[model samples]
Target: MRLYIDPGTGSMLFTILIGLVGAGIYSARMLIVKLRFILSGGKKVDMNANRIPFVVFADHKRYWNIFEPVLREFDKRGVDVVYMTASPDDPGLQNPYPHIRGEFIGEGNRAFAKLNFLKAGIVLSTTPGLDVYQWKRSKEVQCYVHILHAASEATLYRMFGIDYYDSILLSGEYQATDVRNLEKLRNLPAKDLVEVGIPYMDEMKVRFEKAGPAPKHETTVLLAPSWGPEAIFSKYGDQILKVLLETGYHIIVRPHPQSYTAEKDMIETIMKKYPESDRIEWNRDNDNFEVLRRSDILISDFSGVIFEFAMVYDKPVIYTAANIDTSVYDAWWLDTPLWTTGILPRIGHELNGLNLPMLHSIIDECLNDTRYAKGRDEARSEAWEHMGEGAVRTVDYLMKKYRELNPAERPDKEA
Candidate 1:
């Protein structure tokens, strides 16, 4: 019996078959992964014999800015790396890095894209967007390193899917120890997390020192507000404006790229309200480190920026979590206060009812304390202990591990 069908129907059937085949392949991969665990329960892959093509995902522009060096290192190691960026923020992309650039896929198609990278080698992500972060963390990868942006321990442990990670390179020993504790927190055996310190900071610090002393800007205040599902304007937007105008410090309110893109009108409204608030510098492009380098004092809550200000630049950060609900937030954010890493004052939890006067007074205290200069150096020591210094140590260790497992040029693993 000859089966007859319209051309469209045939095309649809073929598409369906392709989809089914992909699902089957993914399923088989899952089965093989389980079998491998059964085969080698507690053993690292033989990196010496294996060579992984690295695929690093950079979701936001700023993240890409920070991750460029690690990608270059991967290239230097002869890692066939795929460095991707979704946002057009990276001007350097005009003269793109020598390694492969994988954009357009975004996070929705991560599984398909991941498989592509997996077949080639290991896929690594230094800064993960929500969707990409989820796909990578949901399952075990042969070699995917999550070099989280922050040097905080609590942030990594409380972060979802730590169990599935192969190696979490620590920015410092403090963060590394915190990651190791995930064993008890999640009731799994103690696993090792690498302490590399912050590659990003090392890059920044070198650049700053070479650039020479930062031009003394007036009492500079950096105001970066969070955006999306947890956008900033909703909580303490207006209130921050009131205080910033009154205090007279140089203010730069850079919205999270997510928030700026998602809520254009809201961003405009907020900008309109505070036209002269400290010479607003909205970073709708790349080069955030420039803004940070210029600013003296920093203010924010929950965002990774606090770590940047306190650790990398040796600046004191005032966390105005005026919009957060502490009891709910502490658990949800999971990561403990940054104070554990550096001096961090508690946030207001609620936006409007915040004691703005008290907040200013605290700011005054920090400003008056000439000892803060010394304290910043202390924070750097703490960061070094937590994240590390050389910046290359952690990556070197992982590459060393990778070489041990797979000596071949193509070990069938990706970063």
Candidate 2:
């Protein structure tokens, strides 16, 4: 008899094996720290004697837009901050701010190792899964603040992603309610949930205002989907493109950046199958404002870009009907339905096998429909409040928290 294992089980086993290896590495590192302390006759290691007062960590360069405004606020107020990133080519490294110092700290496990031993008064990050994966909380760090990069629900993160964080800066009050629900469900201590609005969207609004309107062109459809099994491209691939091309409308496909790396083979196959032409163009621009401006209607799955389009662009969206598996996410713990899914029907139309054949009609409806306008206004109010004041409010919260953690080193005035 031959032994057999399914792909799902095999993947799960591999993940467990990797996790065990990581645990061993972490144990060894801690043992070394302990041994050093014992050898020094009960004295602390003091790896970072000159502790940094404020620190910001970016796991990828893509999030620079989200942090740039806050860093600028810090600079304008004459406050010092350390910007650490895993990507060597991060734009934050090139920032001319006198008060902000940026440094590249390698990537993956190496970056996590450096962060696990950091010493800071308050460490702010957009990345989640602290103390759940490779990134462990450092004892020397007084506070860990996690800020949302999207206007979506905070429960959408992977299991226990933000559970260990000291505080979470939310974009809306609904998110705070969900966070509190999770805390009560898990018997966890409630952390600070501040509704500071969406900083990147505010920045995008400024850029859009300066760039003016997009040049007039043919009716355009932007297909921007999240990168995962539940995403549109991952499920239907070029089939969706074939359907859109039949409508004789210009189509733009801007895949999630992660698709280029995580699903490289899938993207390559799709691109090879349907090469770019005058009618069909593939977009991979770091900044999506140009493409977004030229688009009439958006076709997406569960990507946060939907909120950006509906809120910032003030346009309508056609979301694909894909069943998102929530078992691996914090959302599984909640009994209520996801807020994103609940609001989709109001703000846009749905695309699935039943309505896929009539995608052209749906696109036409979304483009010409005036009813969704109200939903867009309601969504904007719920997901993003105090639209243009995000950066200022974010800085205010950080400065106040820092002072609370270090009273002796408090500044004379707030930023």
Candidate 3:
């Protein structure tokens, strides 16, 4: 009796059988937690425990955008917000919570603060080392919201961003949809994702609503370029400073913080060369978005600042990817034609300007181009809708999660 299972049927059967086995394994693991921890551990498990956390992550930088709001929320609730730091010598360590000033606590104990938060019905997380360091405690009802300390763009940035939180705050739908399809979250279990727009944009919005007239004779342009495989400095980067400064434009050389050393040296050399050029200024300490809010134009590389500027400021952007390797850089920018997608696919502008004359011509043409200005405005409108204007929406959602639960019901931190 030859009861033959065809190869195709055999493969299908094998797959289904494997799936069942994997499911069985997960089911067994859950059963063990319930039976061993809850049933056998025999300690009365508080079926209801407080879980709304006083949110802030390790070594919280004081100047962060969300600092004030998070503090206000915790104070209203009578909970202490946690802050960790490596610099004990840092002046003015005044706060309601215990500040653990220690060597970047070893990974094993990095989440040492989480236990404290869990005891207080809260979980605060930031950065790669801390996110993975804790969360293994796995308090099912705990609220774990991640307030990104910085803005995100590019597919690669989000992909590398998955390891450290319970919930994510997205800038807008493009970012949400963009992130949803990203290959990075593919491995992550589905969790809550929030699209409340960026928190700092809220700060930008307040000033804009009370918007006063701009300073006459002062048109500030921020020169921001990425710092990586194809940094602006490698390309016609210096050309921007020389052309804008030599002319009469108010140029603010706000390069990436990562370019601190290079930018410093460049600024020193340029200042000596152009002592009479007071029209251009250098401001590194300004909030990035605030600078974008005031800028008349943005000269950048493949930085997210371009998308933000295009969407928010609706201003002309002159990009010089001349130093970027065709093999590596993604040529798809917000709306203006990219060199890779058959959208004006080949620009031969120099990426550097160390005594180069062509760079000046490129900057002049871009600043003066009517078509470039129109495209920038159009792109900004689209980005504004996509990014949304409410940074408070993210905070509101975090608060909503708190209101839904009984704080007294969250699990207490285990000793």
Query: In lDDT terms, which candidate is top?
Result: 2
Error of 3 at 389 (Å): 6.1
**Residue 65 miss distance in model 2 (angstroms):** 1.3
- Superposition TM-score, candidate 3 onto the true structure: 0.60
Off by over 4 Å in 2: 1-49, 261-266, 411-415
- The residue ranges of model 3 lying beyond 4 angstroms of the native Cα positions read 1-52, 58-63, 66-143, 148-154, 158-160, 182-187, 218-220, 226-229, 237-240, 262-271, 274-276, 286-294, 307-314, 322-391, 403-415
Model 1, position 4: C-alpha lDDT score: 90
The candidate with the higher TM-score, 1 or 2, is 2
Q: Can you write out model 2's per-residue Cα lDDT over 1-415, one digit (the tens) per residue?
A: 9999997676556456555665676577679878999999999795545789899999999899999999999998989999999999999999999999999999876787688778788999999899877787876799999999998889899999999999999888889988999999999998988889988899998988888878878999999988888999877878999999999999999999889999999999998988899889999998888999999999999888898899898899999877888999999998888889878898999998778889999998988788888889888888998899999999899999988877768642342
Q: Per-residue alpha-carbon lDDT of model 1 for 1-415, expressed as tens digits? A: 9989997676456445545665677688667666766789856544223323455666555576557667666555555555655555544354355554545344434434444324434455654332223342322235666776664543533345455545666655566555555455666655457666677777777776677657866777777777654544666656776776577666777777767568878878877876753255555445677888887776665677776666667676666443344442213443554444244432111222356555566566665665666666665666555343444575476667656555754422353
List, residue by residue over 1-415, the lDDT tens digit for candidate 3. Answer: 8899997776556445544554565467557656766665676555334433444544534334445444444444444444434334322245533322122322323334333224333454444332332223333435666555434332333223443455666553454554454434346555466765554445555555566435564656677776654766655445556666665667777667767665667656755665544676666774565677677677777666665565445455656553333232222222323322221112212244443455445656655767665664444333233243444465456556665555443222210
Candidate 3 shows a clash count of 14
Model 2 lDDT on a 0 to 1 scale: 0.88
The TM-score measured for candidate 1 stands at 0.70
User: lDDT ranking from best to worst?
Assistant: 2, 1, 3
lDDT of 2 at 300: 95
